[model samples]
Target: MKSTHVLILLGLLAACKSQPKEKETEAPANAPKAEPIACYQYATAADTITLKLVNMGGTVGGALIYKLKEKDMNAGTIKGTLRGDILLADYTFKSEGTQSTRQVAFKKTGNAFIEGYGETTNVNGVEQFKNADSIVYSSSMKLEEIPCK
Candidate 1:
Protein backbone atom coordinates (compact mmCIF):
# COMPACT_ATOMS: atom_id res chain seq x y z
CA MET A 1 0.00 0.00 0.00
CA LYS A 2 2.85 2.39 0.84
CA SER A 3 4.63 1.60 -2.47
CA THR A 4 1.42 2.23 -4.45
CA HIS A 5 0.91 5.64 -2.77
CA VAL A 6 4.51 6.68 -3.48
CA LEU A 7 4.17 5.66 -7.14
CA ILE A 8 0.91 7.69 -7.54
CA LEU A 9 2.55 10.78 -6.01
CA LEU A 10 5.57 10.47 -8.33
CA GLY A 11 3.31 10.10 -11.37
CA LEU A 12 1.37 13.20 -10.43
CA LEU A 13 4.58 15.16 -10.06
CA ALA A 14 5.78 14.00 -13.48
CA ALA A 15 2.45 14.97 -15.09
CA CYS A 16 2.59 18.47 -13.60
CA LYS A 17 6.18 18.97 -14.75
CA SER A 18 5.32 17.96 -18.31
CA GLN A 19 2.50 20.49 -18.65
CA PRO A 20 3.21 23.50 -20.90
CA LYS A 21 3.44 26.94 -19.36
CA GLU A 22 1.34 29.87 -20.59
CA LYS A 23 3.03 32.43 -22.79
CA GLU A 24 3.00 36.19 -22.25
CA THR A 25 -0.03 37.74 -23.93
CA GLU A 26 0.58 41.47 -23.47
CA ALA A 27 3.16 43.89 -24.90
CA PRO A 28 5.51 45.69 -22.59
CA ALA A 29 4.10 48.92 -21.20
CA ASN A 30 6.98 50.90 -22.65
CA ALA A 31 6.81 49.60 -26.22
CA PRO A 32 6.67 52.25 -28.90
CA LYS A 33 3.48 52.82 -30.83
CA ALA A 34 2.76 54.03 -34.35
CA GLU A 35 3.42 57.70 -35.01
CA PRO A 36 1.09 60.07 -36.84
CA ILE A 37 1.79 61.31 -40.39
CA ALA A 38 2.16 65.00 -41.19
CA CYS A 39 1.22 66.91 -44.33
CA TYR A 40 2.28 70.27 -45.77
CA GLN A 41 1.60 72.32 -48.86
CA TYR A 42 2.79 75.39 -50.74
CA ALA A 43 0.53 77.05 -53.25
CA THR A 44 0.43 80.13 -55.44
CA ALA A 45 -1.60 81.35 -58.35
CA ALA A 46 0.42 79.31 -60.82
CA ASP A 47 2.16 76.65 -58.75
CA THR A 48 1.46 74.19 -55.97
CA ILE A 49 3.48 71.67 -54.01
CA THR A 50 2.33 69.11 -51.46
CA LEU A 51 4.21 66.87 -49.04
CA LYS A 52 3.29 64.10 -46.65
CA LEU A 53 5.74 62.82 -44.09
CA VAL A 54 5.94 59.98 -41.59
CA ASN A 55 8.70 60.24 -39.05
CA MET A 56 9.84 57.34 -36.89
CA GLY A 57 12.79 58.02 -34.60
CA GLY A 58 14.44 60.29 -37.21
CA THR A 59 13.85 57.96 -40.17
CA VAL A 60 11.33 59.46 -42.56
CA GLY A 61 9.29 58.50 -45.61
CA GLY A 62 6.62 60.35 -47.53
CA ALA A 63 5.10 61.61 -50.75
CA LEU A 64 5.74 64.82 -52.67
CA ILE A 65 3.93 66.43 -55.57
CA TYR A 66 4.66 69.53 -57.60
CA LYS A 67 2.33 71.20 -60.08
CA LEU A 68 3.75 74.27 -61.73
CA LYS A 69 2.41 76.37 -64.54
CA GLU A 70 3.59 75.23 -68.00
CA LYS A 71 5.49 72.36 -66.44
CA ASP A 72 4.76 68.69 -66.22
CA MET A 73 3.55 67.63 -62.78
CA ASN A 74 6.11 65.72 -60.76
CA ALA A 75 4.77 63.19 -58.27
CA GLY A 76 6.87 60.86 -56.19
CA THR A 77 7.88 59.28 -52.91
CA ILE A 78 10.74 60.32 -50.64
CA LYS A 79 12.63 58.18 -48.15
CA GLY A 80 15.42 59.46 -45.98
CA THR A 81 16.75 60.47 -42.60
CA LEU A 82 16.13 63.64 -40.61
CA ARG A 83 19.03 65.14 -38.75
CA GLY A 84 18.10 67.97 -36.38
CA ASP A 85 16.11 70.30 -38.68
CA ILE A 86 17.59 69.10 -41.94
CA LEU A 87 16.09 66.35 -44.08
CA LEU A 88 18.15 64.51 -46.70
CA ALA A 89 16.21 62.24 -49.02
CA ASP A 90 15.97 60.48 -52.33
CA TYR A 91 13.10 61.58 -54.52
CA THR A 92 11.86 58.93 -56.95
CA PHE A 93 9.36 60.60 -59.20
CA LYS A 94 7.59 60.51 -62.52
CA SER A 95 7.19 63.49 -64.83
CA GLU A 96 5.90 63.59 -68.39
CA GLY A 97 5.67 59.80 -68.34
CA THR A 98 9.36 59.43 -67.55
CA GLN A 99 10.67 58.07 -64.23
CA SER A 100 13.54 59.81 -62.50
CA THR A 101 15.40 59.76 -59.20
CA ARG A 102 17.11 62.68 -57.50
CA GLN A 103 18.52 63.65 -54.17
CA VAL A 104 16.59 66.38 -52.31
CA ALA A 105 17.17 68.30 -49.13
CA PHE A 106 14.95 70.50 -46.98
CA LYS A 107 15.22 72.65 -43.90
CA LYS A 108 12.48 72.65 -41.34
CA THR A 109 11.67 75.99 -39.73
CA GLY A 110 8.78 76.36 -37.31
CA ASN A 111 5.85 74.72 -39.07
CA ALA A 112 7.23 75.04 -42.56
CA PHE A 113 9.83 73.31 -44.72
CA ILE A 114 11.99 75.10 -47.28
CA GLU A 115 13.31 73.20 -50.25
CA GLY A 116 17.05 73.30 -50.74
CA TYR A 117 18.79 74.00 -54.03
CA GLY A 118 22.38 73.38 -54.90
CA GLU A 119 24.80 72.43 -57.67
CA THR A 120 24.23 68.83 -58.71
CA THR A 121 25.93 66.12 -60.72
CA ASN A 122 24.33 63.17 -62.40
CA VAL A 123 25.72 59.91 -61.03
CA ASN A 124 24.36 56.69 -62.51
CA GLY A 125 21.39 58.68 -63.82
CA VAL A 126 20.53 60.00 -60.35
CA GLU A 127 21.00 63.69 -59.67
CA GLN A 128 22.97 64.20 -56.48
CA PHE A 129 23.95 67.39 -54.72
CA LYS A 130 27.56 68.36 -55.37
CA ASN A 131 27.88 69.93 -51.94
CA ALA A 132 25.12 69.27 -49.43
CA ASP A 133 26.52 71.78 -46.95
CA SER A 134 26.39 74.51 -49.56
CA ILE A 135 22.75 73.91 -50.50
CA VAL A 136 20.52 76.93 -50.16
CA TYR A 137 17.14 76.61 -48.53
CA SER A 138 14.71 78.86 -50.37
CA SER A 139 11.86 80.52 -48.51
CA SER A 140 9.92 80.90 -51.74
CA MET A 141 9.34 77.19 -51.84
CA LYS A 142 8.30 76.80 -48.22
CA LEU A 143 5.54 74.32 -47.53
CA GLU A 144 3.33 75.15 -44.58
CA GLU A 145 1.87 72.58 -42.28
CA ILE A 146 -1.61 71.41 -43.26
CA PRO A 147 -4.19 68.96 -42.08
CA CYS A 148 -3.94 65.59 -43.74
CA LYS A 149 -6.77 64.69 -46.10
Candidate 2:
Protein backbone atom coordinates (compact mmCIF):
# COMPACT_ATOMS: atom_id res chain seq x y z
CA MET A 1 0.00 0.00 0.00
CA LYS A 2 2.78 2.48 0.88
CA SER A 3 4.64 1.74 -2.39
CA THR A 4 1.42 2.37 -4.41
CA HIS A 5 0.82 5.76 -2.75
CA VAL A 6 4.45 6.81 -3.42
CA LEU A 7 4.14 5.76 -7.10
CA ILE A 8 0.87 7.68 -7.47
CA LEU A 9 2.42 10.84 -5.99
CA LEU A 10 5.42 10.50 -8.33
CA GLY A 11 3.09 10.09 -11.35
CA LEU A 12 1.16 13.22 -10.37
CA LEU A 13 4.42 15.20 -10.12
CA ALA A 14 5.55 14.10 -13.57
CA ALA A 15 2.20 15.00 -15.10
CA CYS A 16 2.25 18.46 -13.54
CA LYS A 17 5.81 19.04 -14.78
CA SER A 18 4.89 18.02 -18.34
CA GLN A 19 2.01 20.53 -18.56
CA PRO A 20 2.94 23.99 -19.90
CA LYS A 21 2.42 26.97 -17.61
CA GLU A 22 -0.42 29.33 -18.50
CA LYS A 23 1.83 32.40 -18.80
CA GLU A 24 4.26 30.59 -21.09
CA THR A 25 1.54 29.80 -23.63
CA GLU A 26 0.18 33.35 -23.69
CA ALA A 27 1.73 36.12 -25.82
CA PRO A 28 2.86 39.42 -24.43
CA ALA A 29 -0.04 41.79 -23.86
CA ASN A 30 2.03 44.99 -24.22
CA ALA A 31 3.95 44.36 -27.40
CA PRO A 32 4.92 47.52 -29.24
CA LYS A 33 3.08 48.51 -32.41
CA ALA A 34 3.82 50.75 -35.36
CA GLU A 35 2.83 54.38 -35.33
CA PRO A 36 -0.19 55.80 -37.17
CA ILE A 37 0.02 57.59 -40.49
CA ALA A 38 0.96 61.26 -40.34
CA CYS A 39 0.28 64.07 -42.79
CA TYR A 40 1.83 67.53 -43.17
CA GLN A 41 1.36 70.53 -45.42
CA TYR A 42 3.14 73.69 -46.41
CA ALA A 43 1.11 76.42 -48.03
CA THR A 44 1.81 79.96 -49.05
CA ALA A 45 0.18 82.59 -51.21
CA ALA A 46 1.10 80.85 -54.44
CA ASP A 47 2.30 77.35 -53.55
CA THR A 48 1.05 74.39 -51.54
CA ILE A 49 2.89 71.18 -50.71
CA THR A 50 1.48 68.19 -48.92
CA LEU A 51 3.10 65.09 -47.46
CA LYS A 52 1.62 61.92 -46.00
CA LEU A 53 3.75 59.27 -44.36
CA VAL A 54 3.00 55.70 -43.28
CA ASN A 55 5.38 53.63 -41.24
CA MET A 56 5.57 49.91 -41.97
CA GLY A 57 7.89 48.26 -39.52
CA GLY A 58 10.98 50.43 -40.07
CA THR A 59 10.42 51.46 -43.69
CA VAL A 60 8.56 54.66 -44.57
CA GLY A 61 6.31 55.33 -47.53
CA GLY A 62 4.07 58.25 -48.40
CA ALA A 63 2.73 60.65 -50.98
CA LEU A 64 4.12 64.07 -51.83
CA ILE A 65 2.47 66.80 -53.81
CA TYR A 66 3.94 70.08 -55.00
CA LYS A 67 1.84 72.84 -56.51
CA LEU A 68 4.14 75.71 -57.12
CA LYS A 69 3.39 78.97 -58.82
CA GLU A 70 4.31 79.24 -62.51
CA LYS A 71 5.46 75.62 -62.50
CA ASP A 72 3.94 72.30 -63.49
CA MET A 73 2.35 70.64 -60.50
CA ASN A 74 4.23 67.46 -59.53
CA ALA A 75 2.58 64.72 -57.51
CA GLY A 76 3.92 61.33 -56.59
CA THR A 77 4.71 58.69 -54.00
CA ILE A 78 7.88 58.41 -51.93
CA LYS A 79 9.51 55.27 -50.54
CA GLY A 80 12.48 55.55 -48.26
CA THR A 81 14.00 55.12 -44.84
CA LEU A 82 14.27 57.62 -42.02
CA ARG A 83 17.75 57.66 -40.51
CA GLY A 84 17.92 59.59 -37.27
CA ASP A 85 16.28 62.94 -38.06
CA ILE A 86 16.80 62.76 -41.83
CA LEU A 87 14.52 61.15 -44.39
CA LEU A 88 16.04 59.91 -47.63
CA ALA A 89 13.77 58.64 -50.36
CA ASP A 90 13.02 58.45 -54.03
CA TYR A 91 10.17 60.49 -55.45
CA THR A 92 8.43 59.24 -58.60
CA PHE A 93 6.23 62.05 -59.83
CA LYS A 94 4.15 63.00 -62.81
CA SER A 95 4.36 66.49 -64.18
CA GLU A 96 3.30 67.97 -67.50
CA GLY A 97 2.10 64.55 -68.63
CA THR A 98 5.48 62.95 -68.03
CA GLN A 99 6.75 60.71 -65.25
CA SER A 100 10.11 61.30 -63.53
CA THR A 101 12.01 59.77 -60.67
CA ARG A 102 14.36 61.71 -58.41
CA GLN A 103 16.00 61.32 -55.06
CA VAL A 104 14.73 63.55 -52.25
CA ALA A 105 15.93 64.25 -48.75
CA PHE A 106 14.35 66.04 -45.82
CA LYS A 107 15.48 66.99 -42.34
CA LYS A 108 13.03 66.83 -39.47
CA THR A 109 13.06 69.44 -36.72
CA GLY A 110 10.45 69.62 -34.02
CA ASN A 111 7.08 69.44 -35.80
CA ALA A 112 8.43 70.61 -39.17
CA PHE A 113 10.45 69.12 -42.01
CA ILE A 114 12.90 71.01 -44.21
CA GLU A 115 13.66 70.04 -47.78
CA GLY A 116 17.19 69.21 -48.87
CA TYR A 117 18.87 69.97 -52.19
CA GLY A 118 22.19 68.94 -53.65
CA GLU A 119 24.02 68.25 -56.87
CA THR A 120 22.58 65.21 -58.59
CA THR A 121 23.63 62.97 -61.45
CA ASN A 122 21.20 61.22 -63.74
CA VAL A 123 21.81 57.51 -63.51
CA ASN A 124 19.81 55.19 -65.79
CA GLY A 125 17.08 57.86 -66.11
CA VAL A 126 16.80 58.35 -62.35
CA GLU A 127 18.26 61.50 -60.82
CA GLN A 128 20.17 60.80 -57.64
CA PHE A 129 22.25 62.92 -55.31
CA LYS A 130 25.96 62.86 -55.95
CA ASN A 131 26.70 62.92 -52.24
CA ALA A 132 23.99 62.68 -49.60
CA ASP A 133 26.28 64.10 -46.92
CA SER A 134 26.65 67.30 -48.96
CA ILE A 135 22.93 67.90 -49.25
CA VAL A 136 21.70 71.22 -47.96
CA TYR A 137 18.57 71.40 -45.83
CA SER A 138 16.71 74.65 -46.42
CA SER A 139 14.42 76.12 -43.82
CA SER A 140 12.62 78.19 -46.43
CA MET A 141 10.88 75.06 -47.65
CA LYS A 142 9.81 73.78 -44.26
CA LEU A 143 6.63 71.73 -44.08
CA GLU A 144 4.67 71.94 -40.86
CA GLU A 145 2.62 69.18 -39.25
CA ILE A 146 -1.05 69.33 -40.14
CA PRO A 147 -4.15 67.28 -39.40
CA CYS A 148 -4.67 64.55 -41.96
CA LYS A 149 -7.82 64.91 -44.04
Candidate 3:
Protein backbone atom coordinates (compact mmCIF):
# COMPACT_ATOMS: atom_id res chain seq x y z
CA MET A 1 0.00 0.00 0.00
CA LYS A 2 1.14 3.58 -0.59
CA SER A 3 2.45 5.74 2.25
CA THR A 4 -0.40 8.17 1.77
CA HIS A 5 -2.86 5.39 2.34
CA VAL A 6 -0.94 4.39 5.43
CA LEU A 7 -1.22 7.91 6.78
CA ILE A 8 -4.95 8.01 6.16
CA LEU A 9 -5.43 4.68 7.91
CA LEU A 10 -3.46 5.93 10.85
CA GLY A 11 -5.57 9.09 10.92
CA LEU A 12 -8.80 7.11 11.00
CA LEU A 13 -7.43 4.99 13.78
CA ALA A 14 -6.43 8.08 15.68
CA ALA A 15 -9.92 9.50 15.42
CA CYS A 16 -11.37 6.23 16.66
CA LYS A 17 -9.02 5.77 19.62
CA SER A 18 -8.62 9.29 20.91
CA GLN A 19 -10.20 10.76 24.00
CA PRO A 20 -12.78 13.50 24.12
CA LYS A 21 -11.27 16.97 24.38
CA GLU A 22 -12.12 19.16 27.31
CA LYS A 23 -12.85 22.84 26.68
CA GLU A 24 -9.41 24.34 26.85
CA THR A 25 -8.81 27.88 27.94
CA GLU A 26 -8.87 30.39 25.13
CA ALA A 27 -5.66 30.72 23.15
CA PRO A 28 -3.68 33.94 22.72
CA ALA A 29 -5.56 36.52 20.65
CA ASN A 30 -3.18 35.91 17.76
CA ALA A 31 -3.38 32.11 17.79
CA PRO A 32 -4.00 30.62 14.37
CA LYS A 33 -6.54 27.95 13.49
CA ALA A 34 -3.86 25.30 13.21
CA GLU A 35 -0.24 25.28 14.29
CA PRO A 36 1.62 26.29 11.18
CA ILE A 37 3.25 23.27 9.56
CA ALA A 38 4.21 21.97 6.14
CA CYS A 39 1.35 20.80 3.95
CA TYR A 40 -0.10 17.41 4.89
CA GLN A 41 -1.27 15.06 2.13
CA TYR A 42 -2.87 11.64 2.31
CA ALA A 43 -4.56 9.08 0.05
CA THR A 44 -7.48 6.84 0.73
CA ALA A 45 -6.71 3.77 2.73
CA ALA A 46 -10.39 2.92 3.13
CA ASP A 47 -13.48 5.04 3.62
CA THR A 48 -17.19 4.53 4.11
CA ILE A 49 -20.15 6.76 5.04
CA THR A 50 -23.67 6.18 6.28
CA LEU A 51 -26.30 8.79 5.55
CA LYS A 52 -29.99 9.14 6.23
CA LEU A 53 -32.24 10.84 3.76
CA VAL A 54 -35.64 12.21 4.64
CA ASN A 55 -38.01 12.45 1.70
CA MET A 56 -41.36 13.95 2.47
CA GLY A 57 -40.34 13.74 6.09
CA GLY A 58 -39.69 9.99 5.79
CA THR A 59 -36.23 8.84 6.70
CA VAL A 60 -34.23 6.35 4.66
CA GLY A 61 -30.74 5.24 5.62
CA GLY A 62 -28.10 4.70 2.94
CA ALA A 63 -24.37 4.04 2.89
CA LEU A 64 -21.47 4.89 0.58
CA ILE A 65 -17.90 3.73 0.27
CA TYR A 66 -15.25 6.25 -0.73
CA LYS A 67 -11.61 6.39 -1.75
CA LEU A 68 -10.60 9.46 0.31
CA LYS A 69 -7.53 11.57 -0.36
CA GLU A 70 -6.66 14.60 1.78
CA LYS A 71 -4.12 17.36 2.31
CA ASP A 72 -4.21 18.29 5.97
CA MET A 73 -3.23 21.25 8.21
CA ASN A 74 -5.05 24.58 8.45
CA ALA A 75 -7.50 24.90 5.60
CA GLY A 76 -6.66 21.42 4.28
CA THR A 77 -8.04 20.01 1.03
CA ILE A 78 -9.37 16.54 0.22
CA LYS A 79 -10.06 14.83 -3.07
CA GLY A 80 -11.95 11.58 -2.87
CA THR A 81 -14.86 9.86 -4.55
CA LEU A 82 -18.57 9.13 -4.60
CA ARG A 83 -20.35 6.50 -6.70
CA GLY A 84 -23.94 6.15 -7.95
CA ASP A 85 -24.71 2.64 -6.73
CA ILE A 86 -23.25 3.47 -3.35
CA LEU A 87 -25.27 6.67 -3.06
CA LEU A 88 -28.56 5.39 -4.39
CA ALA A 89 -31.25 5.06 -1.76
CA ASP A 90 -34.42 2.97 -1.83
CA TYR A 91 -36.18 5.08 -4.41
CA THR A 92 -38.36 3.94 -7.26
CA PHE A 93 -36.60 4.67 -10.51
CA LYS A 94 -37.99 4.44 -14.01
CA SER A 95 -34.75 5.33 -15.74
CA GLU A 96 -31.33 5.74 -14.04
CA GLY A 97 -29.14 7.73 -11.67
CA THR A 98 -25.84 9.59 -11.53
CA GLN A 99 -23.42 10.66 -8.77
CA SER A 100 -21.60 13.96 -9.11
CA THR A 101 -18.96 15.57 -6.88
CA ARG A 102 -15.42 16.92 -7.14
CA GLN A 103 -12.53 17.19 -4.71
CA VAL A 104 -14.91 16.57 -1.78
CA ALA A 105 -12.86 17.79 1.19
CA PHE A 106 -11.20 21.16 1.59
CA LYS A 107 -9.69 22.60 4.73
CA LYS A 108 -11.07 25.72 6.42
CA THR A 109 -9.40 27.66 9.16
CA GLY A 110 -10.79 27.31 12.75
CA ASN A 111 -12.21 23.87 11.93
CA ALA A 112 -10.82 21.11 14.13
CA PHE A 113 -10.38 18.35 11.55
CA ILE A 114 -10.48 17.23 7.93
CA GLU A 115 -13.86 18.27 6.58
CA GLY A 116 -15.75 17.30 3.40
CA TYR A 117 -19.16 17.88 1.89
CA GLY A 118 -20.83 16.45 -1.24
CA GLU A 119 -24.16 15.67 -2.80
CA THR A 120 -25.90 12.87 -4.74
CA THR A 121 -28.78 13.06 -7.18
CA ASN A 122 -30.67 10.24 -8.88
CA VAL A 123 -32.60 10.47 -12.14
CA ASN A 124 -36.02 8.95 -11.87
CA GLY A 125 -38.64 9.11 -14.55
CA VAL A 126 -41.26 7.67 -12.19
CA GLU A 127 -41.42 10.35 -9.53
CA GLN A 128 -39.33 13.27 -8.40
CA PHE A 129 -38.16 13.02 -4.83
CA LYS A 130 -40.44 15.31 -2.85
CA ASN A 131 -39.67 17.28 0.33
CA ALA A 132 -35.94 16.53 -0.03
CA ASP A 133 -34.48 15.19 -3.25
CA SER A 134 -30.82 15.84 -2.70
CA ILE A 135 -28.18 15.31 -0.03
CA VAL A 136 -25.82 18.06 1.17
CA TYR A 137 -23.27 17.40 3.89
CA SER A 138 -19.94 18.13 5.60
CA SER A 139 -17.73 16.59 8.29
CA SER A 140 -14.89 17.70 10.60
CA MET A 141 -13.12 14.52 11.66
CA LYS A 142 -9.56 15.58 12.30
CA LEU A 143 -7.54 13.54 14.74
CA GLU A 144 -4.12 14.39 16.09
CA GLU A 145 -0.78 12.55 16.53
CA ILE A 146 -1.69 9.41 14.60
CA PRO A 147 0.93 6.69 14.17
CA CYS A 148 -0.32 3.92 11.90
CA LYS A 149 -0.47 0.49 13.43
Candidate 4:
Protein backbone atom coordinates (compact mmCIF):
# COMPACT_ATOMS: atom_id res chain seq x y z
CA MET A 1 0.00 0.00 0.00
CA LYS A 2 2.86 2.38 0.85
CA SER A 3 4.63 1.59 -2.48
CA THR A 4 1.37 2.10 -4.40
CA HIS A 5 0.81 5.52 -2.73
CA VAL A 6 4.36 6.62 -3.66
CA LEU A 7 3.83 5.53 -7.30
CA ILE A 8 0.52 7.42 -7.52
CA LEU A 9 2.09 10.60 -6.10
CA LEU A 10 5.03 10.34 -8.54
CA GLY A 11 2.62 9.83 -11.45
CA LEU A 12 0.57 12.88 -10.50
CA LEU A 13 3.73 15.00 -10.21
CA ALA A 14 4.95 13.81 -13.63
CA ALA A 15 1.59 14.57 -15.23
CA CYS A 16 1.53 18.09 -13.76
CA LYS A 17 5.13 18.76 -14.95
CA SER A 18 4.40 17.45 -18.48
CA GLN A 19 1.52 19.82 -19.04
CA PRO A 20 2.53 22.79 -21.26
CA LYS A 21 1.94 26.38 -20.16
CA GLU A 22 0.29 28.84 -22.51
CA LYS A 23 2.77 30.52 -24.86
CA GLU A 24 2.69 34.14 -25.93
CA THR A 25 1.58 34.64 -29.55
CA GLU A 26 2.77 37.26 -32.03
CA ALA A 27 0.37 39.36 -34.08
CA PRO A 28 -0.74 37.91 -37.41
CA ALA A 29 1.83 38.05 -40.21
CA ASN A 30 -0.64 40.10 -42.22
CA ALA A 31 -1.08 42.64 -39.43
CA PRO A 32 -0.84 46.17 -40.73
CA LYS A 33 1.62 48.73 -39.31
CA ALA A 34 0.39 52.29 -38.74
CA GLU A 35 1.53 54.87 -41.29
CA PRO A 36 1.04 58.63 -41.32
CA ILE A 37 -1.83 60.06 -43.32
CA ALA A 38 0.24 63.14 -44.17
CA CYS A 39 3.45 64.89 -43.01
CA TYR A 40 5.76 67.70 -44.20
CA GLN A 41 9.25 68.99 -43.46
CA TYR A 42 9.62 72.73 -43.84
CA ALA A 43 12.23 73.62 -46.42
CA THR A 44 13.42 77.06 -47.59
CA ALA A 45 9.93 78.55 -47.64
CA ALA A 46 8.94 79.48 -44.12
CA ASP A 47 5.22 79.25 -43.40
CA THR A 48 3.13 81.89 -41.66
CA ILE A 49 3.96 81.71 -37.94
CA THR A 50 1.34 83.15 -35.64
CA LEU A 51 0.96 83.38 -31.86
CA LYS A 52 -1.66 84.69 -29.42
CA LEU A 53 -0.01 85.25 -26.02
CA VAL A 54 -2.29 86.83 -23.43
CA ASN A 55 -3.31 90.20 -24.91
CA MET A 56 -0.31 90.21 -27.27
CA GLY A 57 -0.44 88.93 -30.87
CA GLY A 58 2.41 88.46 -33.32
CA THR A 59 2.82 86.85 -36.74
CA VAL A 60 6.21 86.22 -38.28
CA GLY A 61 4.91 85.61 -41.78
CA GLY A 62 8.17 85.06 -43.59
CA ALA A 63 10.60 82.36 -44.70
CA LEU A 64 10.57 80.41 -41.39
CA ILE A 65 11.15 76.73 -42.20
CA TYR A 66 11.42 73.76 -39.80
CA LYS A 67 12.92 70.25 -39.91
CA LEU A 68 11.02 66.98 -39.44
CA LYS A 69 12.61 64.31 -37.29
CA GLU A 70 9.75 61.83 -36.79
CA LYS A 71 6.42 63.61 -36.95
CA ASP A 72 3.47 61.28 -37.50
CA MET A 73 0.27 63.13 -38.27
CA ASN A 74 -1.73 60.35 -36.62
CA ALA A 75 0.49 60.10 -33.54
CA GLY A 76 -0.34 61.82 -30.25
CA THR A 77 3.11 63.38 -29.76
CA ILE A 78 4.36 65.31 -32.80
CA LYS A 79 7.83 66.60 -31.89
CA GLY A 80 10.98 67.83 -33.65
CA THR A 81 13.17 70.90 -34.23
CA LEU A 82 11.59 74.41 -34.16
CA ARG A 83 14.39 76.52 -35.57
CA GLY A 84 15.08 78.25 -38.89
CA ASP A 85 14.59 81.98 -39.19
CA ILE A 86 14.96 84.07 -36.02
CA LEU A 87 16.72 83.07 -32.80
CA LEU A 88 13.17 82.69 -31.45
CA ALA A 89 9.75 84.33 -31.61
CA ASP A 90 10.33 86.39 -28.39
CA TYR A 91 8.09 88.76 -26.40
CA THR A 92 7.40 90.48 -23.04
CA PHE A 93 3.99 91.31 -21.54
CA LYS A 94 1.99 91.55 -18.30
CA SER A 95 -1.61 91.56 -17.02
CA GLU A 96 -0.64 93.15 -13.64
CA GLY A 97 2.69 94.73 -14.80
CA THR A 98 5.02 91.67 -14.93
CA GLN A 99 6.59 90.74 -18.31
CA SER A 100 8.41 87.72 -19.73
CA THR A 101 9.12 86.07 -23.11
CA ARG A 102 7.36 82.86 -24.19
CA GLN A 103 9.01 79.41 -24.22
CA VAL A 104 7.28 76.21 -25.31
CA ALA A 105 7.69 72.60 -26.52
CA PHE A 106 5.04 71.68 -29.07
CA LYS A 107 3.22 68.36 -29.44
CA LYS A 108 0.58 67.62 -32.05
CA THR A 109 -2.33 65.22 -32.30
CA GLY A 110 -5.49 64.60 -34.38
CA ASN A 111 -6.37 63.12 -37.77
CA ALA A 112 -5.65 64.88 -41.05
CA PHE A 113 -5.27 67.97 -38.86
CA ILE A 114 -3.03 68.44 -35.80
CA GLU A 115 -3.34 70.67 -32.71
CA GLY A 116 -0.24 71.84 -30.81
CA TYR A 117 0.16 72.75 -27.12
CA GLY A 118 3.09 73.99 -25.02
CA GLU A 119 4.47 76.82 -22.88
CA THR A 120 4.57 80.26 -24.51
CA THR A 121 8.11 80.50 -23.14
CA ASN A 122 9.01 77.31 -25.00
CA VAL A 123 8.61 78.70 -28.52
CA ASN A 124 9.02 82.32 -27.59
CA GLY A 125 11.68 83.04 -24.92
CA VAL A 126 12.17 83.81 -21.20
CA GLU A 127 10.50 87.24 -21.34
CA GLN A 128 7.02 85.79 -21.95
CA PHE A 129 6.30 84.67 -18.33
CA LYS A 130 5.21 81.20 -19.53
CA ASN A 131 4.73 79.95 -15.97
CA ALA A 132 1.47 81.92 -15.87
CA ASP A 133 0.45 80.86 -19.40
CA SER A 134 -1.41 77.79 -20.62
CA ILE A 135 -1.91 77.69 -24.39
CA VAL A 136 -2.88 75.44 -27.33
CA TYR A 137 -2.14 76.26 -30.96
CA SER A 138 -4.15 75.13 -33.99
CA SER A 139 -1.92 74.46 -36.96
CA SER A 140 -2.90 76.23 -40.17
CA MET A 141 -0.41 73.87 -41.82
CA LYS A 142 -2.18 71.91 -44.50
CA LEU A 143 -1.61 68.17 -44.33
CA GLU A 144 0.13 67.38 -47.59
CA GLU A 145 2.26 64.20 -47.48
CA ILE A 146 4.70 62.51 -45.11
CA PRO A 147 7.72 62.09 -47.35
CA CYS A 148 9.56 58.81 -46.66
CA LYS A 149 12.71 60.36 -48.09
**Number of the predicted model whose TM-score against the real structure is largest:** 2
Model 4 has a clash total of 20
Between 2 and 4, whose lDDT is larger?
Answer: 2
- Residues 48-75 of candidate 2 have per-residue lDDT tens digits of 9999988856778889999999998999
Give me candidate 2's TM-score against the actual structure.
Answer: 0.75
Off by over 4 Å in 3: 1-37, 41-102, 111-113, 120-138, 143-149
Tell me model 4's lDDT, rounded to 2 decimals.
Answer: 0.35
**Candidate 2: stretches off by over 4 Å:** 1-35
* Candidate 1 residue spans exceeding 4 A from truth: 1-34, 56-58
lDDT of 2: 0.89
User: Where is model 3 poorest over a 10-residue stretch in terms of lDDT?
Assistant: 72-81
Q: Sort by TM-score, best first.
A: 2, 1, 4, 3
Q: Could you tell me which residue pairs clash in candidate 1?
A: none
lDDT of each: 0.89, 0.89, 0.33, 0.35
In candidate 3, how many Å is residue 149 off? 18
Residue clash pairs of candidate 2: none
